[model samples]
Target: MTLLGDLLADLDAEAAELRSVVAGLDADTWATPTPAPGWSIATQVAHLAWTDERAALAAAARTPAGREAWDAEVARALTDPASYVDDGAHELARLDPTELLAHWDAARAALGEALCAHPSSERMPWYGPPMTPASMATARLMETWAHGLDVHDALGARPAPTDRIRHVAHLGVRTRDHAFTVRGETPPAEPFRVQLEGPSGAMWTWGPADAAQRVSGPAYDFCLLSTQRAHRDDTALVATGPDAQRWLEIAQAFAGPPGPGREPAGCADARSPHG
Candidate 1:
């Protein structure tokens, strides 16, 4: 199966797992602060719900003209992050736990169904660039995993890691040029090779070392660092090449403003070796 196919399959499973957790939460627990600053468990779930709904809209409207329309619609649909956050909090707070879980479940299923209908090669317009359907699905999975991690950490719960996050790590490595541009630097010529360790204790590598710099390290580390879900110092990645190292320093898997993220506050729960 294609990378996107693999990611979506994993997403389906993860989404279900998230629902199960949320379903079991008490109202007090729903208001508990997630690892993400200022966001409660309910808000975290709402953010995912928003993303899933947005992705489904993007996926279903893949035509050139349709994409333009979709962009305009979303632009109109969302006000600003502050306002969006407020709306999300309100929506989640108002729903019963069962209804909230159902809403999240349905939104994810919609995204998954749309992803299943398209191949990786099917082109669609993302915020600034065109992406294959597979690329889009990978993006969706990455977002889910990142936010879900917030929920997991807040509850002091540990969810099993999966190979799906490699897609996120790859995106972070591949977006070095974009990151440079965002930083007001000239885009570098060399592409960077990415090597990360997956959750299964397997090594996953991508890119060409000859044509690009090399980004080699544990997959979970790179994924966490890139998503701003974990701090860079908390991970064991060593970017050997100059450009590769630079990419790691400012890597971002998601497209948006730079984040105010840091490594985990404490090293007490540093990653333990997987059996």
Candidate 2:
């Protein structure tokens, strides 16, 4: 399979897992608050559907006008800034739980088709910089996995970790410099080594074998850190150098403004599953 094909497959798998987790939810379960501040289980799925629809529209646009329309919508969303994601999610959440799930199913299917049709070398416009089809798909997978965790945690269930986390881990490593740039800091001139143990017991390493700075941890914790789902103090990840430690604090594999990450494990209302 092509790289893009592989990414799409992984995304489908992740989406499927999430669907299964939420398939039999009762009304009370759907209304349960998740780790995300002011977001319920239904809100989590609604946000995913909204994002998938937007990504599909972006991927399907093949003309300047088509792209411009999507860009205009994105600009409008930015105007609201704080409420962009929440507004869309709340609007969609107004639907019945079953309707919301159906919407997500259709949106995810359309997104997969759109991504498959787009040329691998072409860049698709996003909220931040344009991304290759592979990158977009990987981002979608990361979001699904992260949000799914919120749903699971809200239900007080812990799903077993899987090797699919390798994609998120790789994305985290690749976005090391972007993490620094977003915070108005310069990335270290020398690359930092990332050595993580995958769920399957395989070692996944990035950067040089003997770099001065290094990050070492379980792949699951790394993914949580990269997604800002877990605060550095809550994770078992170890950073050897100052740069590496700083990166841990601000790591974000997804695009957009820096997230207000959840507080460390037990401070007030800090409710992250990973925490």
The per-prediction tally of clashing pairs is 5, 0
Query: What's the residue-level lDDT of 34 in candidate 2?
Result: 91
Per-residue alpha-carbon lDDT of model 2 for 169-263, expressed as tens digits? 99989988888887888888999899999989999999999998999999999998888778889889999988888899899887766777878
- Candidate 2 positional error at 160, Å: 0.6
lDDT digits (tens) for residues 186-274 of candidate 1: 77785666777898888877767475467677888888777776666667898776776777777777776566566565854333100
Among all candidates shown, the one with the greatest TM-score: 2
Superposed by TM-score, candidate 1 places the C-alpha of residue 46 at a distance from the truth, in angstroms, of 1.0
Cα-based TM-score, every candidate:
0.84, 0.93
